[model samples]
Target: MGKTTVIHHAPLVGYPDDKLYTVRVIDGVIDGIEEEVEGKYINGYDKASVEEIDLAGKEWLSPSMIDWHVHTKLAALHSNRLNLSNCQSASEVFESVKQALNDPKYDTSLERNLVGINMRNSNWTDEDLFSLEKMNELSIERPIFLLYNGYHSMWCNSLALEVGGYGSSLNHKGHLVEQEAFDMFPKLTTANNQVVDNWILQESKKAAAMGVTEIVDLEMEHNIVQWQRRYAAGNDYLRIHVGMYTPHIQDAIDLGLTSGDDVPHTDGLIKIGPYKIVTDGSLGSQTAFCHDAYPGTKDNHGIYYYPPESLSEMIETGLKHNFKFAVHAIGDYANHLTLQTISKASSKPRIGSTIEHAQLLDIEKDLPIFKDLGLIASIQPSHLVDDRDLCHKFWPGREHRAYAFKSIVDAGIPIKLGSDAPIAPMNPWEAMAVCITRAGQGDEKNPFIEAEILDLETAWKASTSNGKTRLEVGDRADLCILQSDPLKLDAAGLRAMKVNGTMLGGRWTHKTF
Candidate 1:
């Protein structure tokens, strides 16, 4: 049977249609799909006939991706904070700070000084903060805040330190600054709440155009009021799940906003998610909670964001309030501790429990427990490609335990994929490309455990929640239309596939135009 109709050619139909042998869509929805074969164009039905379209040279079609780990607000604020992060040496950071001081957008009248620096793969030190002579010249002046690429650690300059009253108490390594220091920084924008709320809406729309349908907003600040107002004002366009930051557990408990509350959305606006807790620092920083020293480091094994007992107490608090725990555990020891703590805290498994950034694992020892505990390994595959070298350099002996995707699959643990945007591109195809190829299409060595290169189906599931009721037909038509089938295409081909358009609940959220 043959027929001609306008539609983006995809490998499989997203929904079941037995009566129709083929579907032809005009913009994104089904315009006319022929049920019978051996059909040629008979343009009589003006209302039902689809416009002609040719999509013979494309690949991989699926629903829009759900990047479970993205920070829309933080992503927007990143550009605002770029003055400091793009710096390599302390001098460069200072120069950017000076430039920002002169920028009209930034106000200099604020009492507390707060600035952020972005650090990349370059080496950084406390002295980098200031040359000895420079420090002497700028002694006790204004506050300066420094941020690394990973957003896990920060450096506070001396002048800023005294004003914040953390003068000597803060560690010189620049890794010990707290939220008080973060707050001392100038706000990104001074507009009213509605203006900032509009900012979030604009960012969300941009994410939709990028093929991102869902994002896990892990903001600690309770801008929920802003979201509530914006949502009430008919500004909802994306599916947003928010992680209650670790520090704000008490506020969440006090507000009585328990986990799983379906908040307002102009179109299914907001969904409450897991309670976020940081178990340890990252591996590259040599601050991840590892049992062993980072190869040649002195006696340091990494710092815990909170004491073990405190972590357990926090998990218990979330468990009591019925909030799903989504703890960040990067190192083997940290992952082990987090698993043990959650197991000890709850007798029954929590449905939405997840371990964010399960970057490293003690495969033989830890994989089995994930299945036993029924936790979600919410991970970012792109990080493996970016951090492969660091994993090899800093974690020479533990290469086998790094990003062991196959091992997790073998252990029957359900793993969800995300890009952790602002850190990585928010594109799921790129991530799926990396997941299958293991070789980061850029310059990184392949981190794939060959045996663990997940099949395209699994990778697709990780990209978009494939097995759940949420993805079923008639739930919401939030999906992406791709030019080709992902599974049929090779790794490079998949990465190159074009996202033709996006739909959010049968509405065009993003179009080529």
Candidate 2:
């Protein structure tokens, strides 16, 4: 028989506030849950072997949170790599790179290239956008690659451009956008497998402490093999759904892998996730394929990666293989086009077809279509906290439709919240807080769009798996125990809420008790 455990005085979420409940777990599955009776627990088990935990009605229990979209490898890399997220200007970015070059701490690394991530060029002035001449002035011997915050653009020095075979494609400002930027990513991010693995493990523990139980890792690499290797090396703290990029779609098909299929040798902790495709760029990069032209441009409508017919064909092919689709569509035009493409790809409703970053939408037109087609909207609310000013600048009057969480929910569309980590921090509390307040943490009064703010309940639902609002019997014992009642908290309180414990498969992954 499997191990049995009993939890007493558990304050179950969504349950009545008056009474605390007792929960029973057997081999990572919830067996029973009922009103707690004083000292009346542990039935049908060896008294000595059955472990018991008493919450004393002090903690709140809810399903473990899920980050519906993430690039795990990049997130892991951010821990050790140079972070330019805080640099406000292009000159500041160069100065930081120069400082890193002179710093002895960076010289100890085995990595030959100077790789940096999370630079927001949108915030920089046009005059600050320097050319290769400025980069050359640094006299850097090693290749340098600086990634844009949204992962849609890259700024590389001459050495880096030549190394990535992007010398001929380099623009005046040494910036690469869309496909060129994506193609150069591997060159910049390459490191020893062991070092990468260690980074992943470290990030996993951090995620657990933040109450994350599962992540849909949409890293732009062959994730199956990467995860298999990690699992074999004993990294199993969090459940992972490994997603594939378009380039590896055929590789997955050849291996007979379908979405949600448990990966071999992962101890059921890893599963093959959706076939992910980036149909457009991001707002930060100003390449998010919108309907209206950018502020200065006459007819430039951002970048659209795939033609409509081609996208439809791709979806149709994946659908025939029993693979679920996750397309990245951020701008209004991109979202509209992707919805239409997915709708035309199949006559029947595609159950698990999701639009990742459905960030911008044509509310009147797209909301009804999104609901009717049974497509899920995977959004990252924390993005609004960062992109609120950018949206107003780039999207102008369409700010209301940007990150329209409540509007989507009101239109009866299933919405999932995520961090889009490596872009935003992977904190569900932050995401939930932003969703509820439509403002950044501690800045709750100045909401971006008051009409689109989500309620605490709706935000909580979006954070859990399949929008589960409450814990139930027979569910997997993947749970998060909090120090305070989340429902009673305001936006700031939610953001500051502390996790007392986290349980995965009936075992504690994080515990303060």
lDDT by residue (tens digit), candidate 1, 1-513: 222234333334333322223334333244444433444433353534444433432432356778878766666555445445445566776677667666665554532344564455434454344432353343346555556656665555566555455556654433433344345433423345665566677777777766667777766566455466767876666777767876665665676776767654434457776788877888656678887887767878887677768987787777788888778899888998878777776564588688888888888777777778889888888888767767877788777788887778878998888877666657777888777767777532454566667767787777773433123333445666666556666677767867766766556677663
Per-prediction TM-score to the true structure, in the order listed: 0.79, 0.96
- Stretches of candidate 2 off by over 4 Å are 126-128, 167-173
How do the residues 178-211 of candidate 2 rate in per-residue lDDT, one tens digit apiece? 9888887677755788989999999999999988
* Top candidate by lDDT: 2
Per-structure clash totals for the candidates: 18, 0
What's model 1's overall lDDT?
0.64
Instruction: In angstroms, give how far residue 174 of model 2 lies from its true place.
Output: 2.2
Candidate 2's TM-score reads 0.96
